[model samples]
Structure formats: C-alpha cells, structure tokens
Target chain A: MSSTLQSRWWSWGFRSAVMLYFILLIVFPILGIYGYSLSAGLAAFTENITEPLAWKAVLLTVKLAFVSTMINVLIGTMAGWVLIRYRFPGRGLLNSLVDLPFALPTAVAGLMILLLLGPQSVVGQWAEQLGFSILFHQPAIVIAMVFVTFPFVIRAVQPLLEEMDGSEEEAAYTMGATKAKTFVRVILPAMLPGIASGAMLAFSRALAEFGAVVLVAGNIPGKTLIASVYIFGEIESDNITGATAVSVVLLTFSLLILWLVNYLQSRRKGV
Target chain B: MHVEVRGLTKKFGEFPAVNDVHFSIAKGQLIGLLGPSGGGKTSILRMLAGLETPDSGDIVFHGTRVNDLPPQEREIGFVFQNYALFKHMTVQGNIAFGLEVKKWPKNRIKERVAELIELTGLSGFEKRYPHQLSGGQRQRVAFARALAPEPQLLLLDEPFAAIDAKIRQELRAWLREMIDRLGITSIFVTHDQDEAIEVADEIMIINKGNLEQKGSPWDIYKNPETPFVAGFIGESTIVEDVSTLRGFEQAADWPGTKALIRPEYVEIGQANEFRLLSATETGRVRHLHFRGSEWLVEVDVGASRLVTYRSLEKEVLHPGEEIQVLVHRAYLFNDNDSWIMENRLKEDPMPVHI
Candidate 1:
C-alpha cells in the first residue's frame, strides 16, 4: 500500500515537471512572437502591414490553402471510406503508403518533387511542351502542400467510420430504404463532425507549410511567392519587424479557424 | 404471413452453421425460436429478415421467393437484441426514420410518430436520446421504430436479453399484448425457455443447428419431441436400463424406447413390486434453498442426481434422508427425434450422442 502511494506521488510529480518543461520550451517561443508583434508598437505593425507586396503574398497564401485543403478533404474522405469499409487486394500496403508524408522529412519531400517536375523530369518536359509550367509556380506549391497533408484527413476519419455500429444502416435497410438514401440520411450526419475536425487539421497544417512552398514558389514578388517565403526574404534582407508582423497575421488566421472547429466539435458532443 | 423455409442451409467457411432445416409459420401467428446460445436461432431470424441469405434453399414469404433480396428491398422490421437505437437521434427521430424513408407526407409522418411514441409509452421522452433511457425504455423505442413502417412480418432477436430479469418479465407481457393488439405476424429468438413459454404462441426448439421441436408451451413441457428439447426446455430424470422389470416394456407402457419422467410427475411414496433394486430413493440431500413458498432441494440419488421442489409444512425433509420416489408417466426419446418429428412415438427416439 505504501509503495502504491509512493508511485502515485511519483507519477504526479513527473507529469507536472514534463508539462512545465514543454511550456517553457514551446509555449515560451510562441509567446515571444505574440509579444514582439503586439508590443513593438502599432505604427510598426501598420507600416509593415501597409506594404502591397506583402498583402499580395498573404492573399496568395490564403488561395493556395483554400484550393489545396478542399481537394485534400474531398479525396481523403473517400480514401478513408474505402479503406475502412472494403477489403481489397494490397489494402495494407495502401494504408501504409498514406503515411509516407509523416515519415518523409519536409526538405526531402520538396527535393523529391523537384526531381520529378524540375523541367528535366519525364512529366515536366511534356508539360513544358504543352505550355503548362508546373514547377516554379504557385500551383507547384499547392501540389507539394497537398502531398504533405494527404494523410491527415484520411487518418482522422478512418477510425470513426470503422467504429460505426453498422446496425443503423442495416436497420434502415430493413425499413425499406434504398442504399443510397440510407447513406445520405443516416450515415452522413454521423460522419460530419469527424470530417470537419479532419479538414481543420489538414487546413492548419497546409497553412504552416514553408519548406515545400519555398522550393516551388521561386521567391517571385507579386506573382508566385507565398507569405512564409516572403517572410523568409524580409529576414534575409535584415527586416525583422516586417517578418514578425507577417508571422502574426498568418498565426491569427490559423488560430481563429482552429477555435471555430473546436467549438463545432463540442457542440456536436452536446447534441 | 405464411412463411415457409425449405431446406434452409447456411455455412461459414468450413463450419456448417444451419443445416437443412425446414419449418413454416402460419399467418397471424407468433412463433418462438428457442435454443441454447449459438444454436443458429439468430441466423434463422437474419435469413427470414433478408439480412442473410441461406446457402441453398428457398424462403417463401407470402408465397413469393425472397432468397436474393437485400433487407432494404424486403418489407420487414427487425428488433435487435441490443435495441440498436441511433445514438445521435432522439426517440422521435428514431420513429420518424422509417416514415421518412418511405417518403411519406410530412403531416402523416408527424401523426404516425406521435402515435407510435404513445403506443410505446415514450410520449414524454420523445426528445430524449437512447443512452439516456433504461434498457426497457430503449427496447420500447426500438419496437416503436420497427413497427413504424408497418411491416408484414416482424422479427425480434432476444428483445428482452438486455433488460434486468424483473424488467424483462414485465416487458415480456407488454410485448405480447402490443404484438397481439397490432395483429402482426412475428418471430422472436430466445435462449430462455421461460420467456419463450410466456410470450411465444408456439415454440420452435433448436439444438446444435437443428430444429428439435415446434409446439405450444404446454405441449413442449408435456411431451418433448426430442431428448435434447426435453432436457433443455425443462427438467427430466433418466432411469437407465429399466428393461430389467418383467413385462416392463409392455406394462410400464412408455411411448418411446427409454423411460423419462419430469420432476413434477414423480411421486415420493410406496414402490411397485416389479421394481429394480427395491425401488429405492436412497439419496443424500446436498442442500436446500428457500424459494418463497416451496423449498428447492438437491438430492444425490445414487450415482445420478436431480433437483426437486417440495412443499414444507414444518415437516421438511433434511439432508441425508432416505425416501421413495416413483414415476407415473415417463417420456421416451433417443437423440434423433428432431430429424424425424413424425415418428415421435417410435421405439428409438434418437441415435445416442456418444
């Protein structure tokens, strides 16, 4: 009994210490960004934000995130559905392949894409001849972002689909409902919360992606370069104030979307 | 309505689950599918509901072959053992699902939902989710949902298995009244003999993927067609090698090959002269349990033993008492009586399981 009590105290102290360590290492840096952006004066924040080129980069970043995140959610939901509901040849291998981005380093993923579509690769020459440039363009950055976030939505919704009781559908079928109607009316409502959470995570991950965006954006001003890459350029040119302002803008947008997503999930549970 | 199952067989890989079983349920009748666990009662219900198709054979519902139809295409209502209520929907939503699936008029759906909620005694709880209710209440909601579609044949899989024993008893009577009031043809599967006896209009006893008997509760208790049905559905005592008595086969006049007697039919007084081993009841009373009015006693009669409930007027028999027991009417069965029910009076009732 005394040993059990001792172990309980040990676990409590160990968790508190580990939590404090993470708060200091991770939370402290994010706090520094927020403090520097807000406290360095509104004049600096407005002056840095008033730049048209930086504003254009922000717009491009939003568009890329929207386009890529939408495609990822749609395709990933279908992939999750098929993996959980069906048994096909090579299913295990396909499931493992979905996790390739999680294991592949961001720089290495960018390098691999550059090798495949760097104007000298097989598909790149054909695309060039067709007057459709895929490399060193905004579209190329979206493609790389998609490749990195593909597994997020699939991994999130797969367990939800598998854990579904399946009796409701059977019960619906016995009620003389067509299979299509049962899916639309009975199955989809139950899956919506899971899908939304997955989509939000994918969107946040896509917005924060910089390595792949950097390799493909080519740092073109007012054309192909994204906000993260533009921030990188401002730092390289000794403009820390402008870089901090841009970082804060991007951070606030992602945080607002995440907060909305969490609100929806908790409300769904209440229902 | 008048469902006929001919040569129904289902197999899962190398396991032969439901063999070539044959049975029929007349219209407006409630039939019991009674069996031990894994005796293929649920499998038969699934086949009848069109959720599962037999490997070979035909299931004729109202004289139409429905062997290949999916459950959605078949007009059936299934009450699951666990109720299987939608966790996301309220009681009203669950009942309205079937009407909505049929694309009924909006006002008609509302009227029907209100009627069913009232019928199932869930009017005030229509907005409550399934998890917020008791087991009995959840079962009532499932029943309401299933009957909302007004199915021709209602199928239930152990509807009372999830409720507490007391609540289950009350719900059994309510279920029978509700089903009879609607005049719906129904089939329910249960491993409980008392539940089957209490609720089913006719009982179908199944053992090891085979139909053992199909009869009323009284008939099943009075004369079981098979030994497994007899031993399983109720209590029985086996007095082996009783052919030693002179003219015992003719004088004793048992219908089948062996002599079997129910505990209630056995008397505890004088022994007959043609008795083997002095018609003895030399048993050591192992234990006595107080069961309200009567006492249930466990007696070790020789090498074999059985339980008997006897009345106590303050002259109760204690442990290690020597007494006399006699059988007035005995049943007879070998082992294969289920495979051939037409010959329930035959000399050999079943092939020995051993």
Candidate 2:
C-alpha cells in the first residue's frame, strides 16, 4: 500500500475499534435493556411501570436524590471554596480525602455510616430520643446516597476554584462591595457551571445507588424502597420485565441530567 | 483626597516584603510606585488600597486613619494587573458593578455606565463579555468599573503589564490623560521605568522593601539620591571604589565610594569645559550596537565597562579603538557594605534564611 493509503487505513482501523468498544460495552447493553423492557408490548410496559409500589419507589428515590443533591451543591461548593481559598494545616489531607468516596467501595461506605449513625451509636441514640429513626427510613437512604455521591460536587468544583483568579473578588472589594455581595455577584456566577456539573453527578449517583442504600435503608417496600431497590426486588421475584421497565425510566432521568450538565458546561465555555 | 502611608511594614513570614516604607500622595496627583518584581512595590500598593494589612503602619486618608478599615470601607478603586474583568459580565455590567453594589437607581446606573462607556471608547463593546474583548479593551473596562463609583483614591497594580509593547505605550498615555481629566488621587505600580516615567507625574522607586527615591520623573532621573535609584531608574554604570578609575580624585578618607554615570551624561569623542581631551577619561571601545535612534557603545575603562550612547552624527567607532569620553556629572554614594561583598565575607549574614 502507498504511504498515504496505509496511514488512512490505520486511522480507519482505530476509529472502528473505538466505535466497536462503545457498541459492545455501552450501546449494546442500553439497547438490550430497552428492547427487553418493551418486548412484552407497550401496554405491558406501561402496566409494569404503573404498579403503585413501583411508582412510589421511583418518587421516593427522586425526592431523596433531589434533596441530597441540593445539600451537596451547598456543602460541596463551600467545601471546595474553602479548600481552594484558605490555607489550613490539614488542607492537603482534606483535599485528598474529598475523593475518598470515589476510591472506597460503596458497601464499605454504607457500613461505616451504619456504624456511625445506627441505633447503637451515641448520635443515633440522641436522635432516637427525639422520635426520629435515621436508619431503615428515607433519611437513611439519603445518608447512603450522600456518602456514595459525596465527591461529585467537590471534585467538580474544586479545580475550577483553584484555577479561579482571586483578582475579581479583590476588584469587587475595591469597588466597595461587601464580601456577601462579592460572592453573590462575582464568585457565585463563576462557579455556577461547576456547581451544575457536580449537582448532576450527585443526582445521577443518588438515583442509581444500590449497595449503600440497600444496607442502610432496609428496603421497606413503598416507604424506603428506592427505585434501584425496587428493581432488584422485581428481579428477585422473577419479574425481569418490570425491573427493566423501571430501569428505563431511571436511565432516562439520568440521561436528561447528563444532557443538562453538558449544556451548562458548553454554555459556560462558550461564554 | 490625599492619601498618606506612614511607616508601613509588611512581612510574609520571615521575609520583609515592605519594610518601613513611607510615602504620601497629594489630592488629584498621579504617582507611580516604580520597582522591579519582588521589590515590594506591589505590596505597598496593596497595603495602601487596604487589600493587604501592614504589620505595623497607619494608612491615613484625608486625616482619617484607615489602618484597620476593610477594603470595602476604604472607598478606594483598584485596577488589577490582570485587568480582572468579570468573565461572566458584559462590559456595561462590569462598569456598572460598583454602582449596582452601592444600590444606585437603575436609570442612574444606566446613565452613568453609558457615560463611562463613551469616555473609555467602549461604546460598541457594552454587550460583550470580558473574554470577548482584547487586552487593551478589557483594561479600559476595568478602569471604567473602578471609576464608576467615584472613589476617593484609585490604585492600579501594573495596569499595562499585560498589554503588548505597542499597545502599552498607547494605553499608558491614554490612562494618564483619563486620570488627569478625572482629577482623582491615583497611584499605580509598575516595574517598567519607562512606563512610570511616561505616565506618572511623580515616581516613587523602591528596592528590596526600601524606598529609594520619590520625586518627579525628571527629578528622579536627573537627581537619583542613591546608587540603587540611579541604576534602577535609568541606564547607569555604577563604579564602586571610584579611586579605581584614572583621572579621578583620590579620596583616602572615603575608601569605598561609588560613582554613578548615566549613559546620556557620558559624552563620546568630545571634550567639555570640565575635562579636556587629554585630561578627560580614555577607554577602549568594547562593543557597539545601533539602538534605533542612537548607538549604544560600551567602553572598557580597565576596572569597569562604561555604557554610553553615541548619537547617529558621531563617527562609528570599532572594537579595540581608544575613545575619549567626558562625564558631565556623576552621583556618588557611600558603598559602605555592598550586599554581595558582605554575603561573601560573612558565612551567615542573613539571620532569616527566607
């Protein structure tokens, strides 16, 4: 083969390899799940999804994910800002620990939370006296989801904050702006894209959380049973169609969130 | 408003970034804090702007002591070296930020912003964000924003440091004109001596956290008080141990004296009334280069190389040729303890390693 033709052949080969990997690993599995879920016809798919228990499980999961993502956006943004802006003795250690959730197994995180906040713990006993049960309830599911998704917002926002020039904040202060106003008008807008990306990751992670949630939430059907737990219960009962149907809905929600995150990131970069 | 910085000192850990630096600016005067990088010029500017707190000092603005005041309460406008225009804000929004933060009425803000936009020649860029603007354009936006709230004092940290050379000259002239028209007490820090000379009515030269000289550009250039100012502010060849040069006065009383001779003050191929041709100093030409308008000729005087510029009208001199040069005036300073010699002599002269 001529040199140009040989190089072109290699380029096409690499391109095809990448496409094949995506097809086999991602596209094929997603398409199979959707096809299998709809194999029993649209009516059966709709009926399986409309099961009151399944609907409640999806709602609970979404509510919990939304709440936890909101919390993450606040606490994670503050954590990221503090880590990037302030100099403390253990800052380096704290910065590395932000990625602990990503490195640790979800089951281990669940057990750690269970041991720290379960009924036997001091904080858990104090909470129990206040007529609130953290374990085996909606809060437990949220706590587990938060633990597994803890790094999302912090990781997403930390680098941007680190790269951010503090001159703008200094400029604001020179313009007679209070610290609160500077953060709101100047700092927050600059961080919005990072915060949006982080919130999306937290939301998606919360939506799909299984190992941590299953251990801490106790999988009480219709009350604490999240969408992932509900799908697992369906599969255990030999209801593959129902499980796949609920998976499709959860996947769609996650896809929408991913699209939003991409949109925000692109817009920020374009601006 | 006039601003006074008295006995200002700041230390970063063991490093004294600005030590006992004191200077004051009159109302509506434009002063330039001129120095090389890490010379404490920026630190002094920051302290005056209330951005950095001094270790021990009193920053008084118009008789009011603002030492402990926060930057927001200082009523100062600061333009950062990087421009620091808000990336997410439009030109108008950036300019109007100060006014908006002060809670000015919407119509008043619009009016003020439009006026500033026109004044800064940014009429067409009102809707554009900082990233979309060029370096010069962003600089104008930063200036307009700082001026929006009508600050009592304006501080700029290397305003044109980031601009291209050609644009920097233009911006420097334009900024000086604008500041004069606004008549606000302003001080800008710059490492470029040329920029400081061209733009500032008064230039304050600092070196290694010490204030070397503070005067008008002409005065500072012509009459630098110390050897540091003479060498830093303009092109000067500092000859320590002035007794080394031939045809120099013998001063046994002051053994370690340094003489500063500016390149322009060294007359080549001519004898002035002070020194006749044979009586004047003679040095061999080491190298010569055309400096666009003049030729920069370096002549070796045995102990030191003397740098002087030859006008285009002068005859071209080659290497190894003896040239007669006359020094119109020389500034002398007591080189009591040269830092380099002291460091070489003492094993641990610097108590603080930093």
lDDT of 1 at B227: 74
lDDT of 2 by residue, B145-176 (tens): 99999899989999998999999889998998
Candidate 2 lDDT, A1-271, residue by residue in tens? 5999999999999999999999999999999999999999999999999999999999999999999999899899999988998999999999999898989888898898889889999979998999998988888888888888888999888878876688889999989899999999989988888998999989998999998888889888888999998999999999999999999999999889889989988988888
TM agreement with the true structure for every prediction: 0.89, 0.92
Which 10-residue window of candidate 1 chain A scores lowest in summed lDDT? A210-219
Most accurate candidate by DockQ: 2
Residue A172: error of model 2 in Å? 1.2
Q: lDDT by residue for model 1 over B1-354, one digit each (tens)? A: 789999999998877778889998998899999999999999999998888878998999999999988887668899998787877899999999999989999999999999998899997999998878999999999999999988899999998998999999899999999989998999999999999999999999987788888999999887777777777877777656334321233423434455455667544422342244333344567677899988877666555455677776645767777655443455555543322112122324344777
Q: What is the lDDT of residue B140 in candidate 1?
A: 96
Q: Model 1: per-residue lDDT, tens digit, A1-271?
A: 9999999999999999999999999888878887887687999898888798888888888889888889988899899989888999999999999999989888788888888888999888998899898888877888888998899889878877876778888888899888898888778777777788878878888888888778776778898878888889999999888888889888888888789888987887677
Error of 1 at B164 (Å): 2.2
Instruction: Name the regions of candidate 2 deviating beyond 4 angstroms.
Output: A1-5, B240-247, B250-254, B270-278, B302-304, B336-354
CA lDDT of A91 in candidate 1? 96
Model-by-model lDDT, in order? Answer: 0.81, 0.86
